[model samples]
Target: MRTAAYVLVRHELRLLASLAMWLARRTHGAGGGRVFGYARGQGAMMFGFAFVCLVETLTMSVLLRDYPTVHQMVFVLDVYTIVFVVGVHAACVVRPHVLDPDVLRIRRAVHVDLRLPVDRIAAVRRELRTTHEHADGELDIPVGAQTTVTVELAEPVAHFGFFGRRRDIHLVRFHADDADSLVQALGQALAGAVTQARSAPSPRPDLPA
Candidate 1:
């Protein structure tokens, strides 16, 4: 029964996502922007969960509509509002990561925006597995991505998590369809940023008397 329900929820979310994508394309035209990475399966699962929550909210609202007590209606409304907010958050999470010239921006499903600087990226490498021994401070955008890119940072970056939790992360891991291509892009961007920094003239020093 649980598996059947899960499948139904996924189906609904996929339908909703398809409609939303179609509307977006019609409004904005094709080729929205260059997206570096996507949550893929992880995103689908989250959207499915969101769809289930939304359906439950609607059902509760309908059931409580005829209730005499005003508090009951208010409570139903509040639950619906919370579910709507969570659904919006899930939609945001399903959006792909936007790659800019100098920064990589990930709009997480949980309402967190992670912006990583290209210059601060120390190294870009591909790992066979997700787990690591020295992964004390690591950030994985979509957890459980098979083709993963491990980005080592030159300096520790403070990342804010859900519920006011903040931690310093030295590594950023994410799954990409084409891990090799992503690595190449990062390498080129890092090299360009480094070269630009080096070519810029330094401030002149004043002679001491």
Candidate 2:
């Protein structure tokens, strides 16, 4: 009996892990999977751009004798320089979002078993809106096959509705997300776990992302 019980426990853990892995992959979506590829493409384009800019600048410098228009050249160079800087900055921010070491990586990952325990639950921060006296936020709510929820928070307002304004309350805030199904499932599971932790006897530990 003891040997059989041990074997069963190992098998169950393996099954659960497999399910969790599946869910993680499913939730990541095709865009997430191609993050690395996107980053590589962007890097290549930037390199090519830099090479062309260098050649153009050098050629223009040599041709200064023929078209000695200093002001126009300065203006063109200034605009091009700004564009290059902005492009590089954008690439840096997007690189992490598509790479493995992304800062916004999931905090916890677990199997789809709703009965699983929850230790720490952090609110998803979709879009953060701030004001002098109060702060508001919005969550990406997928309405259906092609709908979405966009909420705006207002301070000192009784509720965070569409008409909420910046003034009136000392402070106010709201939040939302686009991952409706996963978030809803996670919420229900966490709520149940919280209830169980209070009444039932069990050890609920935090899961790794």
Candidate 3:
């Protein structure tokens, strides 16, 4: 119960922070690293859902006028529901996938944040996959029911779920607004990392007197 409450409170705070970031027209923790956003595909759908919620709110306000207590309670819930719907999208907008030189940060809203070391990435390509099986070592983060970029790791990386469940991920598939660009950038970053590793000079053996 304590863990559940903590998770709930943390989610609410994250939503509020996301809304603030959205209003401020800034992203979260995307400095120096290249940001790849996956929020574009769901914007229209989320707004449409919010519009439907608004309609329901107005309809309820008229229908429940006689019951003062009931109307007040319903009204509060309606407004909060609308905000929650919009806040989910805002979270996605603010927290995008970040690709740094050393780590590839993959995130989905407030739930999933998996950082894979660049050296562990074996291959990355632009592959649109709509169907995914429930696998033990694969993690799929799809936007609008489709994944655009696929990443295969040389070694498994540890991912902890929202409820503190650990999973070893050897394959990662996710969506990005500009899939090609993200794939290209990540490939280049991986290549650069490899080249730097190879080109690094080894320390000379100590010469004995």
For all predicted structures, in order, the TM-scores are 0.60, 0.27, 0.95
lDDT of each: 0.63, 0.36, 0.92
Task: Locate the minimum summed-lDDT window of 10 residues in model 1.
Answer: 25-34
- Candidate 3 shows a clash count of 0
Ranking by TM-score: 3, 1, 2
Q: Write the per-residue lDDT of candidate 2 for residues 53-133, one digit (tens) a residue.
A: 776777666767466688467648845664553344243323221112111122111111111113433332233333223
Candidate of highest lDDT: 3
Candidate 3 per-residue lDDT, tens place, 107-207, comes to 88888889999999999999999998879899999888999999999999999888888899999999999999999999999889989999999999999
Model 1, 1-209: lDDT tens per residue? 24657655664464456346544642111134346544454556656676776677667667777774954766667665555544443454345565667886655443456778888889989765655444568877644435377788998888876534688998877766567777777788888999999999998999898
**Which residue pairs collide in model 3, if any?**
none
* lDDT (Cα, 0-100) at 156 in candidate 1: 84
Clashing pairs in 1: 93-109
- Model 1's TM-score against the true structure: 0.60
